[model samples]
Target: MNLYDLLARGFPADRSRPAFLLGDGGEVSYAELEAGAAQVAGHLLARGVRPGDRVGLQAEKSVEAVTIYLGALKAGAVFLPLNAAYTAAEVDYFVEDAEPAVFVTDPRSFLAEAQAAAPLAQAVPRADDDVASLIYTSGTTGRSKGAMLSHGNLAANAVALHRAWGFTPDDVLLHALPIFHVHGLFVALHCAFLSGAPMVWLPRFDDAQVIAGLARSTVMMGVPTFYSRLLANPQFTRERAQHMRLFISGSAPLLESTFAEFEERTGARILERYGMSEAVIITTNPLDGERIPGSVGYPLPGVELRIGGGEETGVIEIRGPSVFSGYWRMPEKTAEEFTADGFFKTGDVGRRDLDGRVWISGRAKDLIISGGYNVYPKEIELVLDELAGVTESAVVGVPHPDFGEGVVAVVIGAGDEASMIAECRRQLAPYKSPKRIVFVEDLPRNAMGKVQKNLLRDRYTDLFTAG
Candidate 1:
């Protein structure tokens, strides 16, 4: 069955239930979602999208935008959602590489492109292994790689999380996360759809909006930034969140301080889970058991997580249906990603406790994920190295209160700090641009000439630490 076939399993049971409650006091019910998505699918086909072809969508979050995603799935087109923050130059690289049949930006464009064809209101049955979506993930290599998520991979993870997270029809998700990322789009939306739950959708995370919605919502999934902001606000009282049954943190590491603080404030424990774009969701701290700080807890059902056994923290390798099949059009790299034992080598350095809980220490990759967005140091360094005053540059993530990791650039050359920052802002997305740029005489290097980022990380450890 196609991923759409699996996704529509619960729509019938709650046809009148709101799938999306827009910030503007409007709602899109489950039935409306199916119908709108069908129209979008037909529109995609009319616009020259075919089975297995990629559909590039970069737009602000809306019910219409999400329907377009479902429509692409129904038409069997790979739904590739680029970050709205990505500049046109950055978009060009992905669009050129993926060669999407249709590139959609606004509601008018989506509707106009699909207007010629009638609604494709039914599921387009697909083989389990057929490609579903191609989401880009930056690796330690600094270049972005598209991970090929299959219908089976998505279905398996959704079903597993439904069971693991204890989702039900009664749950109402207070959704504030962006629709582009896997955490918000795939995990949050899939679990809501599969469980026949309604969503109170906010355009973006505003502390005021979240606190107002918390009384009505039973579940809230967010990055550490969301929780930290809520905790920072004096208005986010325990009574305000009385109706909220669950709070989940992911996409970036959840600080131990935030976790303990949240539990203390809410009288309810916030569950911290671990996952990456290569795999939708892998492990989660249990809902019914100890929601441990720093530990992502046991693997979800059907996910096989193993640490490359060593005395210290080891690389986490997984083999399961939920794991992505390969990287898009990169067969050699895909082959190299797996081990002789057939486990997908996750570059995240983690260790497993005796209780089977998993704790992440660091990333083996040089990618910085700030506010749930992937920022490759190489991408930024490439731009910096091109400047007249720069010989070379190294980028590293330092601790941050709100963004989880703040991007900091250490430059080897003497350039006006403002000029370098402004240049980065011109070339890269706002999230990918370094928050701080430091002029260093030389970067710490090891005997093999590899820049010791760990040393730099230690030196600037308090960059974002509060006084």
Candidate 2:
């Protein structure tokens, strides 16, 4: 089935059934959603979007944005959602590399030099292997690579997740995550769509809004940060959350402390899962079993998981219908990422116990996930290296109380910290920028002269905790 078809498959026989209950108390119904997506599909067609063509969208979170995402799928166009935090320069890299057919920005934005003048063409029938979306993920190499998730990849995961998480039509999802990433658009949206569940939508996460949403909702999926922030709010008591059936966390590892505290406070254990842009979701804690803290749980029904390097802790490798096809325009890099046995190397270090529960130790790629957003050190280091009075910079994710991991910059430089930070803010999205900048005489290096990020992490592991 085309991933787009999932949008309308089980849409209630009653079209008036609410698909989304806006934070402002407005309701968007099934019929309205269908009409809205069809209209936006028309717009994308007018902009020359067609099957296999990449359409880039960088807009703030809104109901209209969701319409456009669904519409792009209907048009058979690959929906590429860029983070709102990315600067124009960062977006240019994606546009130039992906060579998308259409670039859709905010209505007021003048970032696009050429607009699509050609009208829509006939619909292209999409097979299971047809690319559905392009999510750009960079490594420590500093080059952005687009992961091509096929229609089959998306549909398979949605089907598995709906079953694994025990989603049902009666469930009401409290949705607050940004639509740019897999956690929101693919995982969260798909579960809600597949189950015919109504989503209580929030433009962004707010503790008060989540507290209010919990009263009317049965399910919620978020990053670790959400639970931590909600736990901080005294109003989010077990009484207020008793009605909630499940609380899912992913996009970043959930601190064991945060997991224990959330269960203690809400009387519901947070079901933490594991996934990345290349794969929608790989593993998830069971919905109706003992949810072990610090473990991401077993692989989904059809997903295969194994440790690649050793019997102890090693890089996680997975193979499943839900796994993405390959990287866009980089066949060689794609080959390098996969093993000879066809399992995709996840670049995430993990271990699986005899019972099959998976535990994430750390990322093999030195990825910094701040507030559930991926921040590659090379991206920030590139920017820092370009500025004056900077010798070198190394970025690492230190433990944070609320964000799970906060981005910290360790530098060897004479530049003024305030000025360097100002430049970063001007270029980077707020989440990727270093929250704390510490100047050291020199970054710790190994015998190979490579910066030992491990040593840096060890040195400043207490940066946030001590404060």
Candidate 3:
């Protein structure tokens, strides 16, 4: 069945039921949501959008953003949701690379800029064969490449998630993550539509607002940062969260301490899952079985996962119906990303335990090589987290003349440098321990809450100038 058919099915069951609750605007019923999407589809069709044509949406998270996303699906257009926080240069790169037929924006001012530079020669109606959406990877080390996600890929993922998560008509999702990323757009919102669940949309995450919504929401899916912030909130009480059936954490590593604290207070373990822009969602902690902390549970029903290179440390490759077709307009890159047998190389190093729970070590690119030994930052960060008065820490690799790259730990919290260094020495080997520690007020983070290690590298490079 087509993905849009899921929303269509909801119309007849209970059109009057609340379909979406916007932060600024009031609630929209299922009937209203259907009509809005239809109207947006009509608008796109009138503007020459046809099935498979690429439609770009650059907007803040709003009811209109949700409508445009679903409407793009109904119109059979590939919806490319761009981060509203991205700079003009970043936005230009995606538009030029994807060559979208039409660009949709919240503000009228950006139309002229898009029309002038985008690669598509002429405006034309959408066609199913046309590329749908091109999601760009965050270029931490190199230029960002667009991961081309087809309608079929997205539809299959939504259905798979619907079955895996036990999403039902009764499920109400508290949507706060930015719609730009696949986790928010495809996994959360799409799954909600596929299951006919109502969604509560927050423009941006606020601890108080999110906690308030949890009282009414049945399911809440968010990144680890969101959960961390929620855990830090003073108003976060068990009384507020008793109504929520499922609490999900994704997009980044869900710190074990944060997970434990949340469960202690709320009596619900935050289900940690794994996914990237290329595959959407690969594994999730089971709904009924043991929801293990620090592990992204077993692979979903149709998803097949394998560890390659070595048993203890290996690259994660996934083959599934939910996997994207390839990177957009980059055949060579696409070919390099997939293996001989067709498993998409996740570029993440991981290992699976006997119980089938997956543990992500770190990104292959982020692995630090110091004095002929490899050190995973996640290991050091976890150890530092256990140290007294260390609130948060990020371990990164910096240029070293002798070792090629040396490990550096930038920490955030109140503690004597001697104690922090001593703690690392106790927990890690000499090579694995951070060579230099820098105390920072806060680490620079991307929109998704991932530490911008590249920025950290630049910042510290100047601080530790060569003698």
Candidate 4:
């Protein structure tokens, strides 16, 4: 069984129903979506992509990008989506590591070539345990590990979210998030696909475009940045968002301030969910019940969640069908990430309330979630240390009103902040670059001689929020 087949199981009986409502007021029907996927699948096969081979794609968000994802599934190939914002240097690392059978940089040209091939009549067969996707998440050591998500994993999470969110064909999703991350690629797209609902598509989150889509859409899934940006504008008033039925946020911690302000402005509380690339979605606030600020509600159906060490608040561990199988080609690393009992260590510090609701306080790892993108401190630190006139650097995430967390670098060196930042932007994705740099004589350290990032974080807690 293929994951695409599972997604199609919930499609509306009529294939002519609109699937994507374009920003220009055009529509792509479900039948057209199917045909596009078929063509792409046929082309992938003709290009020597086997069932288990990886198909890497780094392109701007477009309808063709979505079709490539579906096409990969139809061809039984592992879909590897790289962030479009990734620099060529960053993209080279993923290309060298994943070694995809075919990598497409331009979706329009790729789609044109795909259209010339005969459409595939049927989807290639796949097993439940077969890897469907490889989502690369950075380790604390500055290395990227590919999380291999199986067909069963995606199917299970999609089914769970579709039910939990109460999606239906009547729903119209306001799609604005980028398709590279799990939040956009799997969680948001799967729910809409399972319900056979139409998505009012936007290339990216634009204040004007989102305001326009909100009127015609029933649901919106975004990062905290989206809501924060919307609230910054006077046009995103209660009246403008009165028709929206659901506003979901994930991929970054939604600040309590944003949550309360959004509710005050829209007369609706945004549903916050918890997830990672290893697992598409783990927990979410209830759709029909109360959605408390800063609370990620409960684990999805069939998921077993616990705080590691059995303390009131500790590292979160989970065992569920939706959890990814393991890191690709990293058996030792995968084994270290899981418990003897098979629970995956989430590395996130959180507590489960007596009522079973989960609230994430912070990450045990120094993972900065800036504007919904994961920025590993080591990755940035490595780049910073390699730069000219650098002695050492510690990257920390502090509170930011817009980005949820703003990346800051404390350096003990003689480099100009502008030059260092410019150098970093050249090698890394924009989001991963430090927003601000502070030169220091020395970094705070523990008795063990390890850099105390906690001290750095505490010292700069109000760096962005302060007047």
Best by lDDT: 4
Candidate 4 residue lDDT tens string, 112-139: 9998899888899999999999999844
Candidate 2 structure quality by residue, lDDT tens digits, 1-467: 56778656857778789999988889999777777666666666766666788878888887777877877788899989988878889888989988888777762232121132232233346899999999987434558789999999998988899889888899999999988888889888888887777999998899999999988899998877788788888998989998888999887656566787788887888988888889889998898889998789999988999999666777899999999889999999999999998999998877899898998766776878788886767668767766776656788999999899988898876778888888899999989888888987876642212467877888899999995
> Looking at model 4, which ten-residue stretch has the lowest summed lDDT?
445-454
Candidate 4: deviation at residue 309, Å?
1.1
Q: Note each model's CA RMSD in angstroms.
A: 11.3, 11.6, 4.5, 11.1
Error of 3 at 295 (Å): 0.8
Pairs of colliding residues, candidate 1: 43-114
Best by TM-score: 3
Which pairs clash in the backbone of model 4? none
Residue-level lDDT tens digits of model 3 in 1-467: 44566546644377887778866658888776676666666666767777767889888777767777766777777778888887898889888877777787763343323233323212233332344467888977678888877656766777778888888888889998888899887888877876777888887899989988887799999988898888788799898989888998888888888889899999999888899998888999998888887789999888999997657777899998778888777899899989999999998988999878899988888888888898888889899888877778889888887777888899887778776787789888988888788887888988887788878888776433488
Evaluate all candidate structures by whole-model CA lDDT and list the values in order.
Answer: 0.84, 0.81, 0.79, 0.89
Clashes of each: 1, 0, 7, 0
- Give the TM-score (vs. native) of candidate 2: 0.77
Sort by lDDT, top down from the best: 4, 1, 2, 3
After superposition, the stretches of candidate 4 with alpha carbons farther than 4 Å from their true spots are 367-467
